[model samples]
Target chain A: MNLPPLVQTFVLHFGEMGSRWGINRTVGQIYALLYLSKEPLNAEDIVERIGVSRSNVSMGLKELQAWNLVRLQHKPGDRRDYFATPDDIWQIVRTLVEERKKREIDPTMTLLREVLMQEPASAEERHAQERMREMHDLFELLTGWYADVQRLDTERLVQLLTLGAKVQKILEMKDRLFLVPGSKKSRRDDAKDK
Target chain B: MNLPPLVQTFVLHFGEMGSRWGINRTVGQIYALLYLSKEPLNAEDIVERIGVSRSNVSMGLKELQAWNLVRLQHKPGDRRDYFATPDDIWQIVRTLVEERKKREIDPTMTLLREVLMQEPASAEERHAQERMREMHDLFELLTGWYADVQRLDTERLVQLLTLGAKVQKILEMKDRLFLVPGSKKSRRDDAKDK
Candidate 1:
């Protein structure tokens, strides 16, 4: 519970930004604490440091586990369950994005699809469908591209991101190469996907 | 206020997903209504349709305006203000990303930078600082790449995303091209050997 001042400052800042991050104060604080800790921590440690009720820590851990943001571990000869953020920082980022898409985007995409399935009975409804269609298409492309980028290994992902806008020039080059007659079909297909 | 079943379903669904999106329920519902509306809607129209108190709609509108997600308009011969989402859906997406980064990411980045500047007083704090450094570096990469991608016009963004993992192959090709005696890509990258 006696966190160094540096760690404590981060925990407090995270708690303040909790609502903005779509988590409660205790949840954000707990995650931040675990994120900065060198080792796993039990509920007692969280409650003591965060100064929240035991039940608040329990609930925060439950929500965090549900989001796959925290992992549970058992110490040798110790019965208390300990929690830690995933060790791979990039994995944490990937999990955050995937979990968020599952919660916020997938549901809206479903709703948009369901609504689009309905027949519009009025001009207003028809106009509404146009907007929904635009949303649906945008989400489809975005999610598809996200999945593609998400599947890469952390090194590859970092490379892709570091490449930045240079990727656009590469795509143009690929197109020009494809213009050549009798280009390798299998290579073309491979580059086109996966 | 008399929304067709299709539109109403989306409104309700979006409201349900509001907390997940880091917005209040009424704010989500209001945005959904405005997003699908053919014309700008006044507060009365929002209250009547959303079935919330006038004050609730007013607060929701105020929050939306603060987030820059909604635009305020004045009607000829009407004293009441009207609200509508940006007409360009891509622009709306950009605004949401920019606003969220400003509110949620920028502050955290500042905190991380400040905390990182402090000297660690103990071994535990040194380990914690390592974790913080990793996070700081990851965020620096992500935010930098995001800014690069964000600066591109929508057409270019779509092209870059649509290119998908093919971007990796292009990088490899560029590397090989630079491997020639007088290559252009700078031979120093050969050490990466990725």
Candidate 2:
């Protein structure tokens, strides 16, 4: 499948992005193809369209399926599986964010907790542990906040993204307004607190 | 040169994270050391400290220097270069954001622009171009907005992150308050049309 120049650029960029994001080049390229293609594409079509090996396409598809980034479709009278991205960009964004948080944030938080539990053998150890504590607390608040933010409607999410600098102003004032800004804030904060 | 168990965990996690964030594992491990260490360490020290090869430490330090993530410190009596990370997490965050935007976001925007200028040869080509344009615009705005946000003081950044759901709610309302609902509006939208 010969790609149009525009999509070809997207494919190449996403491939590079995949490495940056810890995914492989082939996975990124396959995702780019799926994201751009208007129709549900079968494995052979992806292999043909993207000019990758059939096995590579198969593996990439499996990874995409694992990430919940693709929806499977089967044609009438056809046993081959086809895949396409959801129409909603927000859904795609949410999945990417959630999946990443699960892989990166949650595990790091767990490791942090274990490190914090270790007894300090020296002043340096104590200082290091203190820093770990700060990071762990921050990440916990951050992950919880993001999960809650993810629960917002797409429009609401976009609103937050577009807030530009206003969001900064609000965050700085939050502590002043509520003194103790723990997870147990108020019902309003809890409403969106996921 | 042995590391505390907790620090060892940090190193391994950062090594994994480095790959995810487009940095090499060794480089990430070196960075984790720099971040957690109480003093500036030389390249040889880092090699011994992390139990990695000298060449690997050299390469990792080179990459870290390129990212502007690590600062090289000079010791009066020592001939070797020493490195350390800023104590401020916010500074590191800003540096990473800026570097990633430069590497990934900026180049992709340029590619999108070039593709947009090409005349469409078919309806499919036209559709692909349209999608590219949307992606390009969204990314440009996002990076621009992020740059603006990055300029905010730490107090402001924390304020924004803490805004959480409220920020999301505000972003969702961009359509009603702004002209041209559900359409691509440039920064020029703020200015009246002739």
Candidate 3:
């Protein structure tokens, strides 16, 4: 309740967003506090800052830890555990993406694969399989692309994201030069001195 | 309840996934049915297929329509309303992304900007604002990239996605050939015949 004004506003907004997403509002508030803090905060600090019950703070911190959204720390000679968000913002984004894929996309893909394995006994079943195939293919492409992007280091990710649509030129160039491997046009280009 | 076995399995999976995400299971089942069906299905058809009550089917359709996840139709002779998912799977993906951005992302960005405008009266406030800036900038980069990708037609999107990390070469190429304006090294590369 007595957070810095700016931090209070950010925490309140996240609290609202969390409830809208069916997450406990306290979880988001707890995360917002940790994210803005320069130092780790213990459960008592979180409960006092956010005006929540001790039990709620405990539950929220536990949920955040489950999501890999926070790191728990213990100071020397201190009995209480403290929490902090990952220092790098990009690391947070990466974790969110990874968790979403694991929770939502992977399960759907698995279900689609299971149904795709079933033999179509009727015309309707055949049509349903076709639809599932389309869904599965789209997930495959997106997940595959994400997996590739995820492997890149954070610096490389920033470069890739900043490139955005400009990469279209590269795709076009690749098709022209590499698609027709060993074409005369491709040969002339790398030779440059001609 | 009497849907083809494959269709039933697909619908059941979506229902489970929907409930997991706090969406109504019936809504997911209805969508699954329509997504697989070759022809538009009336509300009664959904009720019969999913074994839900008429009112639940009506409400589910309304929910789907609200999310822009389904198309409403009317048979020329029948008075009952009918529904179907958008035909192209990519179009469905685009709609889901747009709706999520509208519901979840846009509001958070607005709130972040609002807090960013507040005058920082203390070091704590300043540090909080700096963290906000990092989150805001990351959102900017992601939204910008997505906006660029969204504008591309499906063909270009597929091409872009299929390129995947291989585009790292292009990023390097861009930095080498196009990043600096009018450098001698770049000039030599572009003026191939010289």
Which candidate number has the best lDDT?
1
Per-model TM-score on C-alpha atoms: 0.90, 0.84, 0.90
| Ranked candidates, highest lDDT first | 1, 3, 2
Return the candidate ranking by DockQ, descending. 1, 3, 2
Clashing pairs in 2: A1-A48, A155-B172, A159-B171, A159-B172, A160-B167, A160-B171, A167-B160, A168-B160, A171-B159, A172-B159
What is the C-alpha lDDT profile of model 1 across B3-85, one tens digit per residue?
78888998988888888778889999999999999999999998889899999999999999999999999999999999999
Model 1: per-residue Cα lDDT over A35-62, one tens digit each? 9998899999888888889998999999
The 0-to-1 C-alpha lDDT of every candidate, in the order given, reads 0.86, 0.77, 0.84
Clashing pairs in 1: none
Model 3 chain A weakest lDDT span, ten residues long:
A185-194
Predicted structure with the largest DockQ when compared to the true one: 1
Looking at model 3 chain B, report the run of 10 residues with the lowest lDDT sum: B185-194
**Backbone Cα, N, C clashes tallied per candidate:** 0, 10, 0
Which tens-of-lDDT digit does each residue in A22-91 have in candidate 3?
4778998999999999999999999899999999998998888888999999999999999999999989
In model 3, residue pairs whose N, Cα or C atoms come closer than 3 Å (at least 3 residues apart or on different chains), thus clashing, are none
What ranges in model 3 sit over 4 Å off?
A: A181-194, B179-194
Q: Tens-digit lDDT track for model 2 on A94-118?
A: 7887898888778888888888888
Error of 1 at B24 (Å): 1.0
